[model samples]
Target: MAGVFGLAEGEVKTGLRRAARLVLDTLYPPHCLACDAAVLEPGTLCGACWVGAAFQTGLSCDKCAAPLPGDPAEAPVLCDDCLRVARPWSHGRAALLYGGTGRQLVLALKYGDRHDIACPAGRWLARQAAPLCRADTLVLPVPLHRARLFHRRYNQSALLALALARELDRPALPDLLLRTRRTGIQDGLSRAARFENQQGAIAPRPRRARRIEGRHVLLVDDVMTSGATLAAAAEACFAAGADDVDVIVLARVLREE
Candidate 1:
């Protein structure tokens, strides 16, 4: 239905959208994602922020996405932490190492109510998570306890999971896992204490059990510290009759070297 100046309706709509964006950008101006520095694009980091981000590129651990110094051609690598610990999930990937600009972005999205960060972080996650996905895989987030959800108003991990699912064109069940117990914050806890705290804390809902049965699952979360939280979530998936599970997170926290 061409109406104006021999242009198609779709073209007209696109032109209008571009015009609106141009006006808005001119007024507001784009800023760096991690910092407030001006950037040419909306969802980009500045030159300094880019250098400080520590995005994972090559030679990463297969079980968890920690950086390793080795040949890029190597296959099926494991980091020291993953090797020492028993991981219930089959595989894992992360978009960034949790420090510098990456850590700031995570904290912003998690506690500062900066939901806009999810859009860019999700794209970064999707790139790392793609190779781990399967046709039958069901993507879902590590659930937050009801109390925590009420206080925070939104679950940042669920937002990232939904964004990743959209990018991959896969099915996502956001409420598949339930945090039955309200465990306190895991920050500053030792490795063993963290695992003990998360133990048996999450489980699948009985009514929703059918949705998880026999499905291959991909668990998503914002960050992986001790990995105790993910392990607990994966264990819940298995309890719900999942065939197997893998994990992906926006960032992976590394122990001091």
Candidate 2:
């Protein structure tokens, strides 16, 4: 019968697609981003890599997400660095401490063309940032200068922001924040120097300023070191009449040494 033949054809097509997928997977099995060892799933690390990653949990600083030393009962403590410096954002969270596997993952994503890492990393960030997400929250990434954007071809922060936005069901506006000027690398810079370098580096786009007005804006970045860059970005959002600004990073540089 005609109906029977159509069902058989549909089954054959499904079988062909499954066979193709199996062949492709065999040729290029998913591998760990950090160690290059084959993993059971994509966007995941191997067992050894997971063991090395220092994920931030438990009691932490309310402002910067720094790991607190004392008993869990004494929470909401501000770290020494936060106490001395006034951060622009109200709250911040980081998925991993910037060392060991976390450092390796960040390097791979930023330089090694490993964009797949964003999915897993963003999912983790989404969980960490959930407390800040709201119906009117606008999610965005730290913008890159035009020159650097051209050279890199893609902004890794934007990739993570996009993924995080999807997970949180928030509106992602990549162009909301603009890097008005380029600054030198912040590597090995003192805290004060980093703050000075980022001065006037970022601003909200004039045409898109209204989008940020009166809304909770969440800024995403690959890593946070001195908190200077994030502070600068949050300042811009606040200047544009944003109700509040929060930050979420894939990793946080807990120590320089």
Q: Best TM-score goes to which candidate? A: 1
Q: What is the lDDT of candidate 2?
A: 0.89
Model 1 stretches with alpha carbons more than 4 Å out: 1-3
Q: Which candidate should be chosen as best, given lDDT against the real structure?
A: 1
Q: Report the error of model 2 at residue 209, Å.
A: 1.0
Q: Relative to the unseen true structure, what is the C-alpha lDDT of residue 232 in candidate 2, on a scale of 0 to 100?
A: 88
Per-residue CA lDDT of model 2 for 71-162, tens digit only, reads 75786688998998898999989999999999999998998888988999988999899988988999989999989999998899999999
* TM-score, every prediction: 0.94, 0.90
Q: Residues 73-165, candidate 1: write the lDDT tens digits.
A: 896889888788889999999999999998999999999998888888889998988988888889999999999999999999999998899
- Model 1 scores worst on lDDT over the 10 consecutive residues at 248-257
Query: How far out, in Å, is residue 35 in model 2?
Result: 1.4
Candidate 2 TM-score, true structure as reference: 0.90
